[model samples]
Structure formats: structure tokens, C-alpha cells
Target: MMIYLTLFLEFFKIGLFAIGGGLAAIPFIQELSKNYGWITQEQILDMIAVSESTPGPIGVNAATFAGNTTAGIFGGIIATIGVIAPSIIIILIIAHYFAKFSETSIVKSAFSGIRPAVTGLIATVGFEVARTTLLNMEKYNKATNNLLSILDIKAIILFCAIIYLLNKYKKHPILYLVAAAFVGVIFKY
Candidate 1:
């Protein structure tokens, strides 16, 4: 019961402030991993991968995954509701008033400002994720002085291959995800 309440409240706060979209919620999820013991950094990465690969919104999926991991099915339900509740309420309010304020400079300026901030947030999350996935910090810390030893060569190669394929093929994302999963399984990544 207490865990459910905590999950709801934490996810509610994330939903309220994660402005752009599911990707925007990632930093908040990362914070949860840091501040609470409910999830780990590795688990956050897994959550992101699974969330992206599965259906529905990534934020809701992450909340459900985290809550379910922490507690149970009921916890997942509560957390999902909590994460989406803010968006629902905000959308309702915006829908009611947006027409009246659509032409106002204040509203326009607010959105203009929000766009850059959201972009920055999303970019930061991307960098963090890349750093965690491509580089092995533990290896870096353990290494005597060899810089190349710190890099996860296999992961980097896989990442580059995926990026190249994405650019060259321009196929649906699911295809890439499936291919990556197959590669990971085959290579034991």
C-alpha cells in the first residue's frame, strides 16, 4: 500500500513536469533510479529499450515497468494512471481555454520558450543514454591508463551498425529493433 502510494506520487510528479513527451520523462525516471532504490540504472536502460520496442507511450510503459518491478500488477496500474493523469487534466484545461488564448502573444511566447527547453532536455537524455550504453564506466575506472579499454567495442559497433542501417534503409523502426534484438541475442550482448 505504501509502495503504491509512493509510485503514484512519484510518477504523478514526473507526468506533471515532463513537458515534451515520453522521452522527456526519461530524466525524471533516471532521477527515480538515483533517489530511490526501487530501480537501478541498468533497469532504467532496459525499461527504455522495452518501452520503445513495445506499444503505447514510453512514459506510461516506464511507469508501469518500474511500479510492477517494485511492487506488483496493482502497482503497475496505479503508476500508469498516475503518470497519465496530469496529461489528461492538462489537456482538458488547454482544450477548454486554448481557443480563447490561441492568438495571444503570451501563449505563443510560452510555447516558443517551452520548445527549446524541451529539446534541451531530450538532447541531454540522449547523451546520457548513449554514454551509459556505449561506454563502460566500470571498466574505465578499473583500467590503469588505456583509454580504448574503457569503450565497449561490441556495443559501439552494434550502435554504429544500427545507425548506418537506419539511415541507409529508412525502414520502420520495428525492423531495426527486431534486428538489434537478434544481433544482441546472437552476440550475447
Candidate 2:
């Protein structure tokens, strides 16, 4: 149907320009969600968490989740294909020319330029995610847009705890994630 077609085209555009990786695609996905009213900002965060916890690439996982939510199984299939098509094409093209261009200064310069831009994109996404995670937007809006009142103490404490644990122990991330989940459930944060 038309919905499936639209899903494919939209995700195709996302995959085409989503350089760096899945985190880099967050902004584009946010735009897509906003433009289409396909999902809420909170849902996007949930999708990111689920995608990260799952085995597949975050962008692909997000596309499939969005497509499924929008339509059905067929939509998931089509959207996933659409999202990955560009990567396949680009990889093929790069594989064909990489050996020839690997030593060229122009290619090296281009990659060097891209590296920082990608890092910035990822950092931007991280900032956005942290802002959403640590703040209560609804409370802010309800409290006449007071910034201080919007700060979620539980979230901030949890965030600090996670950071402290990460710095102190340097243990596997899953342990931290599990501990956070347990805290969230117990405190209802």
C-alpha cells in the first residue's frame, strides 16, 4: 500500500545519508518521527534502548520497529531492505575503488574530514539522549517551562551512579545496564 511505499522511501533516504553508524542516524530518525507523527520522542528513546540491547545495528533495528509499528510484518521487511540498500550499494562501490584510492591524498583527506563530522554527529546524539533521559519534559512544560523544576533527581542520581561505577570498576557494560534497570524499577524512575 501507499504506507509501505512511503516507509521504504523515507528509510531509504535515512540510510542513504546516515553516515558513521546507527547513532549518527538518530537525528534523521527524530526528524522522520516528527514529520510523520509516527512515534513520540519517548518512544524513540525506548527504540534506541531496545536497539542497543539487541544484536543488530541500531538503525536497522529502529527502522524495523518503526515500520512494524506503522504497518505490519511486510512493512518491517520492506523498510529494513530500504534502509540497508544504500549501504550495500555504497560498500560495493567502495570495494571496487578502495584499493586504487587508498593511497591518494584526496581520499585520505576526505576521510579525515568525515571522521570529525561523524564524531560530532555522534556527540550531538549523545547530548540529545542524555538531555531527554535526565529531564522531565512534561513537567517542564507544565511548570511554565521552568528549567530547574524539570530536572529529574532520580535520573540524575542514577546517571551519576552509573558514571561513578564505570570510572571506578571498568566492568562490562551489561552489568551497569542491569543495575540501572533494577534501580529504575525499584524507584519507579
Candidate 3:
């Protein structure tokens, strides 16, 4: 009971402030792992992979995954609602008044400012994810001389292969996800 309420409130706060999109919510999710111990950094990485592969918004998927892991099925439901409620309410309000203020310079300026900030947030998330995925921090910290020992060679190779394939084929993203999952299972990365 108490857990459910906590999940709802925490996710609600995330949804309220995660301005850009699901990717924008990742820093908050990372903070949750650090602060609450509800999930681990590895689990957050898994959540991002699964969320990106599956349908639905990443933020909602993350909320569902976190809640389900923390509590149960009902917790996932509650958390999903909590994450989306703010967006729903805000959209409703904006829809009601946007037409009247659509031409206002203030509104335009606000959006112009928000765009760059959102880009920065997304870019930071991408860098963090890549760093976590490709580098072993434990190895880096422990290694006294060999700087290259920190690199996860197998993961880096796989990442490069995926990037090359993505550029070459330009097919639907799901194909790459499936291929990556297969490779991950086989390699145990």
C-alpha cells in the first residue's frame, strides 16, 4: 500500500518535470536508482533497451517497469497513471487555450528556449548511456597503468557493428533491436 503511493508520487514528479520526452526522464530515473535503490544502474539500462524496443512511450514503460519490479502488477498500473496524468492534464489545458495564444511572442520564445535545453538533456543522456554500455568503470578505477583496459571490447565491437548496419540498411529500428538482442543473448553481454 505504502509502496504504491510512493511509486505514484515519485513517478508523478518525474512526469511533471521531464519536459522533452521519455529520454528526458532518464536522468530522473538514474537519480531514483541512486537515491531509492528501487532499481540498479544495470536495470535502468535494461529498461531503456526494452522500452525502446517495445511500443508505448519510454517514460511510461520505465514507470511500469520500475513499479512492477518494486511491488506488483497493480503497482505498474498505478505508476503508469501517475506518469501520464500530468501530460494528460497539461495537454487538456493547453488545448483549451493554445489557439488564443498561438501567435504570442512569449509563447514562441518559451518554446524556442525549451528546444535547446531539451536537446542538451537528450544529448547528455545519450553520452551517459554510451559510457555505461561501452566502458567498465570498475576496471578503469582498478587499472593503474592500462587506460585501454577500461574499454569493453566486445560491447564496443557490437555497438560499432550495429551502427554500421543501421546506416547501411536504414530499415525499421525493430530489426536492429532484434538483431542486437540475439547477439546479446549469444554473447552474454
Candidate 4:
């Protein structure tokens, strides 16, 4: 179907550009979420969760998952392959040239320059994800109704506590995620 082809191509582009990791794919995925009604912002957050918990690279997992969600099992397969294809091909090309130019100063300098740019891109993606998840003005709209004020307070307190606890023990990411999920289920009325 045309839909599957589009999914594969878009996700392939996402995979190509997301140089850092799954988090780096957030900005692209958010754009995809907007471009296609195939998913939502909440689903993007959920995709991040699934990607982190999965066995392989988070980007690959996310591509396949989104593909499956959009089309079907074959969509998942195609998207995963499409996304990784460029990386595999590039690596092969690089590997072939690397041996010939492994000691070239210009290539080494180029890599050094690229490393920081990649890190910056990943950091920017993190900020966008955080803004999408937390720092939005619409959250304040919940204060308009007397019944909504309670929800607002709960959301703020739980968010603060989760952030504090996660920061205090940054080593245990899974624990923090579990705690956050518990807070969501218990506090979100």
C-alpha cells in the first residue's frame, strides 16, 4: 500500500538523521506524529518508553514499532530495514575507505568536529521532548475549573518528586520510570 511505502521512507529518513540515539529521534518522530495522524504526542512518549526497554538500538525499535502501528507486521519489517539500511551501507563504505585513510589527519579532524555537533543535536532533542511532555501552557488551563485544581496540584507535586528522585539516583533509570508510571496511574484521576 502507499501508506506502508510512505511510512518506510519517512522512518528511513528519521533513522538516517537521528545520529545519536532514540532520544535524538524524538524531534523527528514528533514531526512525524504531527505530519501523520498515525500517532499522538502521548504515543511518542510511549514509544520512547518501549524503545528504551527493548533489546536492540532504540531508533530501530522505534521505527519498527511505529511502522507496525501505522500499517502491519510487514510495515514493521520494512521500516526497520529501511531505517537501518543507510547505516549498514554507510558503515560498509566507511569501512572500506577507513583502512586506506585510517591515519589521515583531515578525516580525524572531521570526526572530532562532528562529535560535538551530534551531542548538541541529541541535547536539543531532549529539550524538545521535555517541553512537549511538561513545559506547555495548556497545563495551566486545568486551573480554570474548581474540580481541575486538584489535578493540577497532583501533577505538579508528582512531577517534582519524580524529577528529584530521578536526579538523586540517575544510575537507576528503570526504577525512576517505574515510579513515574506508578505516579501517573495513581495520581491521574
Error of 2 at 83 (Å): 3.8
Superior by TM-score: candidate 2 or candidate 4: 2
Candidates in descending TM-score order: 3, 1, 2, 4
Error of 2 at 189 (Å): 1.6
lDDT of 1 at 54: 90
1-189 per-residue lDDT for model 4 (tens digits): 898788878877977888866678778878988888887888778888998876688888888888888788998898898888878889999999998886899988988999999899999988776655654446455546544533345555767887787788676777777777877788672
Q: Residue 137 error for model 2, in Å?
A: 3.9
Top candidate by lDDT? 1
**Residue pairs in collision within model 1:** none
Off by over 4 Å in 2: 1-59, 62-79, 141-147
Q: In angstroms, give how far residue 18 of model 3 lies from its true place.
A: 8.7
Residue ranges of candidate 3 with Cα displaced over 4 Å? 1-79, 141-143
How high is the CA lDDT of each candidate model?
0.89, 0.87, 0.89, 0.79
The lowest-lDDT stretch of 10 consecutive residues in candidate 4 is 145-154
Candidate 1: count of backbone clashes, pairs at least 3 residues apart or interchain = 0
Q: Give lDDT: candidate 3, residue 169.
A: 85
Give the lDDT of residue 74 in candidate 3: 95
TM-score of each: 0.60, 0.58, 0.61, 0.55
Cα lDDT of model 1 by residue, 1-189, tens digit:
788888999999999999877989989988888888888888888989999989888888989998888788998899899999998999999888998897799999998999999999999999999999999877865447878877999999999998998899899998988888999999999
Error of 3 at 69 (Å): 8.9
User: Positional deviation of 91 in candidate 1, in angstroms?
Assistant: 2.7
Q: List residue ranges in candidate 1 displaced over 4 A.
A: 1-83, 141-143
